[model samples]
Target: MTVTFSYRSRQTWADPWDDYRALRDEDPVHEVGDGQFWVLSRFDDVFAAARDTATYSSANGLTTAPDDMAGFDEKARPIVMMDPPDHTAMRRLVSRPMTPRQVAPVEDLVREFVTDKLDAVADAGEADIVEALFKPLPSFLVAHYLGVPTEDRVLFDRWTERIVQATAESAAQDGPNQQAFLELFEYAGGLIERRKADPGDDLVSGLVQQGEDVASAMWIVGFIFTMITGGNDTVTGMLSGSAVLLDRHRDQRRLLIDDPTAIPNAVEELLRLTSPVQNLARTVTRDVTLHGTTIPAGKKVLLLFASANRDEREFGPTAGQLDVKRRIERIVALGYGAHHCLGASVARLQCRVALEELLGRFPDYSVDESTARFAAGWSTRRYEYLPLTTN
Candidate 1:
C-alpha cells in the first residue's frame, strides 16, 4: 500500500495518527511531492536524522517549503536554522538566561499569572480557553521572562502573534509578516541599546553584556525574536491541546487531579501526545540511506516529530493512546540534538503550573468540541479557540 503524505492536507491534522501509523508501518522513508522532499515518520529514523546534524544540515533552512518561502533569509532566520559553530555560539549565549536555575525563579510568577487568568473566568461558567487562558498566559509569561516592560506586553504579544501567523504557513506572503519583523527588530534594538547602557538582571541585558561586536547585537535581536516566536505559540498549543485531551481522557485527568506530583509527568506525556510543532525540515548535506530508501544530497527532509513521538516502536503498543501514567524515558517532542529547544524547561514549568491551577479550579470542566476550532498549518498545531464549560 502506498501512503500519500502532504503536510497541507486538512485530513492530516484532522486525524494525523491514522496517517502517521500508515507512514511508519508501510513506508518509513516516504517521498512526497513528486520527490520534492522526503518525510521520515518512524521513531528511530527521525531521531537519527535529528541527531546526525552533520549529514542533515540546518544551514539552508528547516522547513520543507521551498527556499523562496517568506522570511527565509540567513540574517533573519532563527538559531534553529544554523548548524555547527555558529549555532553553538548563539545557543550558548541564549541558553544562559533560560537555564533551569533561571527558569525556576519564574515558577512563582507563572503560578500567579495562571491563577489570575483562571480566576477571571471562574465565575463565567463557560469561557474560551484559548482566549482567556491559553493565549494570554504564555504571552504574558514569555514577556515577563524576556524582561519586556509591563506596559509593553500587549505590543509584544501582538508582535509575536504576527510573526507566528506570518511564518506558520510556508506559502504565506502577508505584508504584516515583514512589517512585524522590522518593528520587532527596531523595538528589540532599542531594548538592546538600553540594556547595554545600563545592564540589568534580565535576559536582554545578559545578551547585551555578553556582546563584544556588532554581530553580537544582531544575534541579540535574533535571540529575542526566537524567544518570543518560539516560546509563545508552542506553549499556547500545548496548553490548549492538553485541555482538549484531558477532557476526552477523564481518567487520565483524574490521575493528575488526585496526585499533583503527577502533573510533571503529565506535562511530558502531553507534550509527546500533542507535539505542537508538528514537523521541521532539514537539508541533507550528503546522500544518505535509511530504511532501504536513499535521499540524495541537497534534498529536503521533513522530520515528523509528531509522528515519531507516537511511533509504536518507541512508545510500545499504546503509543497512540493517552496514558499519563505511562513512563516515557525520552521524548523527541522538543526536537533532538544541537538545536533542541532552549526553552524546554520554561515550557514545562509553565504547562505544569497551568495544569495544576486549571485542573484545581475547574476539576469538572469539559470542552465544547462542537465549537472548538484549531488553527491550520502542519508546521505548528494550535487551537484558535477552545470553549470550556466550568460546570
Candidate 2:
C-alpha cells in the first residue's frame, strides 16, 4: 500500500479528475495511507455507496468527521450521520425551506445582489471575487432566510468558516461545527423560546411550535449551517472557476455571450469538472465488495467524487474535456441516492440565475489568473480569491 506522491498528485487532489480517470481505468479501489480506508474511484461505486445507506452506512460521517466524534455522544450524530427512519424524518422536516421552489422568491433579490457587485467592478481592473461577491452573497442570503439580524450577518459567516476550516484541519490531522452549532443553538434556542411566546413566518418559528424537540430544531439550524458549509464554497468555486475557464476558452465565452441560453449548460460542465466538495466517505455496516475489493465492517471508505466525475470509464474518451453541452444529471457533484445534496436544486437555480444575470449585465468577463487563489483543505476545494475584469 504505497501511495505515490506524483507532481500531479498535488493537482489531482486539488483538481482530482485526472487521477480518477486513471484509477477508474486501472483499479477503482486502492488502499492509501496506513491502510485506514479504501478509496472508491469509479462513479457507480461512489453513487451506490451514497444511495444505499443500509449497507454502506452514514454514521461514519460524510467526507470525514472529527476523530473526537466517533467515540460518540447522543446528539453528536447530525442528520447526515443517521440512516432510515431517523434520517428521513430529520431531513424532511428541515429541508422544506431550502428547496428550489421555496427559495424562488429570493431569486430576483439574488440577481440584483450579483448585478450590484458586478457593477462595482471597474470595466478593466482587478477585484477579489471571493471577498467582493462569492463569500458574502450566499452568506447574506442564508442569514436573511434564517432571520439573522443585519448587524449579525458577518458574525454568522465568520463563525461558520472557522468551523469548516477547523474540520479541514481535523482531516489533515483529528470535529461538528460544534462551536458554531452551540452559538447558533443558543441563538436559535433563544429565538425558539421567544417564538414559542410569539411565532412568525421564518423557518425557525415554524420549527419551534410544531417541529420535533428543541434538539431537532437545533439540528435544523445545524443542517442549514451544513448546507452553507457544503454549498457556499462550491458555488463560489464554480463561479470563480467558470469565470476563469470562460476567460481561458475565449471562443466558448464568445459563444455564451452570443446565446444567453448557453449559460446554464456552462454552469453544469463547470460543476462536473470543478467539484467543490472533493471527497465523501461512508462507514461499512457489513462486508461489501466493490469491483472485487472488500470493505470490512466499521472501517470508513471514501468516495473520490472529484476523481470519479471525469473517469474515462464513465464518460468515455475525452472525459477530461469541458463540454458545456454535457448534461450533468446524475453526476456525483451534488451526490446521489437519498442523502444527495438537499440543496442541489436551490444551488442550480441560484447558479443558473446568477450566471445568466451576470452575463446579461456584462457580456464578457476575465479573471486575472496570476492572482487567483485556490482554497486549501483536504475536505474541500474552491477559490478563496479570484480577481476579475469585465467588459
Candidate 3:
C-alpha cells in the first residue's frame, strides 16, 4: 500500500503527529513530490542525517523552497547553509559571545523581563499569551542580545512579524517578506557602523571587531539575521506550546508547581512534545541509501525532527504521551550534530525562566483552546494567538 504526505498542506500543520507516526512506521524514508525529495521520520535516521553532514549537506539551504522558489540558490546562505570548513569558521566567530558563560549574565535580565510582562497582565483576568507575554519577551531579549537600541526594539518586532508571515501560504506572494529582509539588513548595517566607531560589549560589537571586509560584513549581517529571527520564532513557539500543554495536562502542571526544581526536566519534555521546529531540509551531497531506500545525489531530504522526537521506537511506547518525569537522555528538539541550534543554551534559559515565573504567578491559569490559533505551513509551529484566563 502507498501513502501520500505533504509538509505544505494546511491539514498537516493542523495536526502533524498522526502523519508523522504513520510515516515513521510504514515508510521511514518516504518519498514525497513523486520522489523529488525524501522525508526521514525515524529518530536514528534523522540523527544520522543531521550528523552526517558529508552526505546530507546544508550548503543548498536548510529549508525546502516552495515550488515558486525552487530555483533559488542558497549556497551563500550564511551559517545555516554553509558546509564544513566555512560553516565551522563562521560558527566559531558567532559562538564566542553566545557561550553559556557569556549568556549567563542575561538571566537576570530575562527574569526581569518575564516578571514585568507577567505583572502587566496580572490584573487582567485574561490575556493573549502571544501578544502579552511569549512574543514580547523573546523579541526584547533578542534585541538586547543583538545590541539593538531599546527605542528600535519595536521595529525588530515589526520586521519579525513580517518575516514570519512571509513563511505562510497567505503571504507567499507578499512583498513584506523581502521588504523586511531589506529593512533588517539596513538596520544591521547601521548598527555595525556604529559598533565599528565605538565598540560596545555586545555580540554585534564583537562581530565588528572581527574584521571590516565585504565578506566579513555580509557574514555579520547574516549572523544577526539568524540570531534575531531564529531566537524569537522558536522560543515563542515553545513557550506558547508549553502553556497549552500544561493547561491540558494539569497533572504535569501540578508536578512542576509542587517542585519548582522539576521545571528544567519539564522544559525538555515540552520541547520533545512540541518540537516547534517540525522539519529542516538538507541537500543530498551524494547518493545515500537508508532503510533500503536510495536517495540520489542533488536531491532534497526533509529531516522531520518532530516525528523523530515522538518515535515510539526511540522514546518507548509512551512516546506519544507527555511525561515531565520521564527520564530521557537527549532529544533532537533543538536539533543535532554540526548545525545544532547555536542559541540552545539561551533558549533553554529563557524557557526555564519564563516557565518558572509563569507557573509561580499564574498557577491556576488555563488556556481557552477555542480562542487559540496556530501559524500554518512552516517549519516552526507558533501561536498567532493563544488566549488564557487566570484566576
Clash count for each candidate, listed in order shown = 1, 2, 0
Q: What are the RMSD figures for all models against the true structure?
A: 1.9, 3.5, 2.2
Clashing pairs in 2: 66-175, 67-174
Q: What global local distance difference test value does model 1 have? A: 0.83
lDDT of 3 by residue, 1-391 (tens): 5756776443345577888889998998898777778899999999888898898888777766534235534432568877798788778866866678988898999999998888878988789979998988878877887788878988988987776566544463567778887898898889989989988877888878877552367767777777766887788889998898999999989999999999989889999998988889998878889889999898889999999999998899999888999988878999888888988888888899999999999999999877688877568888878998887
TM-scores for all predictions: 0.95, 0.87, 0.94
What residue runs in model 1 are displaced by over 4 Å at the alpha carbon?
A: 9-12, 68-77, 170-178, 212-215
Candidate 2, residues 195-259, lDDT tens digits: the string is 77777766666666665654465565555556556667667666666667777877776777788
Report the alpha-carbon TM-score of model 3 versus the true structure.
0.94
Q: Rank the candidates by TM-score, best first.
A: 1, 3, 2
Worst-scoring 10-residue span by lDDT in model 3: 67-76
